[model samples]
Target: MSPFLTFKTFYTNPLNIEYFYIFLFTFLLALSLIAITYISGKIIKADKTHMAAMLLGCVFPNSGNYGAPVALFAFGAMAFDYAVIIMVIHAFLINSIGIFIASFGSEKSTTAREAMQRVIRMPVLYGALLGVLFQLLHFKLPPTIMEGISLVASATIPTVMLILGMQLAEIKPQLFALRYVNSVTVIRMVISPLLAALFVIFMPVSDTLKSVYILLAAMPVAANTTMLAIQFDVKPNLVSFTTFVTTLLSLLTIPLTIYILNMM
Candidate 1:
């Protein structure tokens, strides 16, 4: 509802056509990474649940509050706008595809068709679709109603954070999988953005937008991954722990990535 109402204003500005390229880049890159992450799990015969947690950790990014601020500070307001576009696209995908993947890894076994069927039934899908429709229709919700939707949408993050705190309280030494944690961290902080940098080389956007894309690609594993792990009862400890570690590690890697981009 929030994303739906919020997206209604999406056309009222100097929004770039290049934004499509950025969305394409983010969507394709995420799916590619997820596929590789899943296949790697298969090669190692990982438990389905653990693999789901790792998939979330390795692919989904912190593009909302985290990536947006970094964009504002790192490259100023214009880059922040680009980052927000990326974040919106990312938020929709994570809510849909991410949810489906999490469901598949739960105790009840599910097939791809079933998982996709479940995804189709998600409200976020409709929210996004209606948003697109409303945008096309030049529709506007009354301000009060839009405000109500926005209020509900705003609560989502704090709730996800509260979930993170609860998951953190459950963390114990036995729950930490250092090998998987390190792998997720390396991929999230290093390889993913490196791939993005290469990918954007031929992209139609300017170098600045390209750099913005790379910085976002380097964001930590999303805290929402923790929420999904908790929701599905799928190795909540490992997923949250990886989220924490990747976030802490990003403090160092983000600056290094920035410097590397400068060199490029």
Candidate 2:
């Protein structure tokens, strides 16, 4: 079959329901983490330290920087819409929800107003908004402009990967203990994607959408998690480790997800 036919076939297949399952699972999983943190903070009377780490792991995924590149390579022009959807979801979560959670245990004690400001300042939001505006206006960027933007966006992935590797190489020995870091790695790299895949299976979205959602869910933790950790005085080392391990392990997990997607 031709590439388009293959995609069409994959999308139309009944197993495509798995996409909705995955999306819901990932979404619920993040929400659950927020609830857990809030409860732990209130009842268990836990300190902000643990809550911070889990929050970072729960919310951050390398959907835009890495997933977009992979989707473009695999899905061609369709990747643009997929990337947009992922960005929209991400912006909503991070701006409205993730920012609220991140504000806690943070020295700056960000109010709702401050969080809204931060949300507005997000570069990904800006880029996605402009891209969508141009798209909706039926305005095509000049070839040169399009090429320049694509070129810059294209570099985001590999550079991030290399930086992640280098960052992992620099991790402190104390931070490598299984007791402190193993659960974060497993949850971020393994459980999160598995749940996302299952969630995608049940949603009413299109088959292509299912595939895109699965791909986004399976992505590694976002590098931005570390930045958030640093900015909020969370467990930066733990967040960085989770990001590193997930990104590294994704070499295997992502291919498996692709195989499963093909079968579906």
- Over 1-264, each residue of candidate 1 has an lDDT whose tens digit, in order, gives 335423532533345678678778888889878877877677666787878888988889988657766776788767766776677778777877888778878975546686566556655446656666666787767889777666775465455445545655665544565667767787788778978987897798877788889999999998778778887887888887787777778879989887887787
Q: What is the lDDT of candidate 2?
A: 0.63
* Per-model TM values vs. the true structure: 0.76, 0.73
Best by lDDT: 1
What tens digits encode model 2's per-residue C-alpha lDDT throughout 86-170? 6445655766666666677577687889878877776555554555455456665577865555566545557755765666677
Clash-forming residue pairs, model 1: none
**Which stretches in model 1 have alpha-carbon errors above 4 Å?**
1-9, 108-174
TM-score of model number 1: 0.76
Clashes of each: 0, 19
Cα lDDT listed for each candidate: 0.74, 0.63
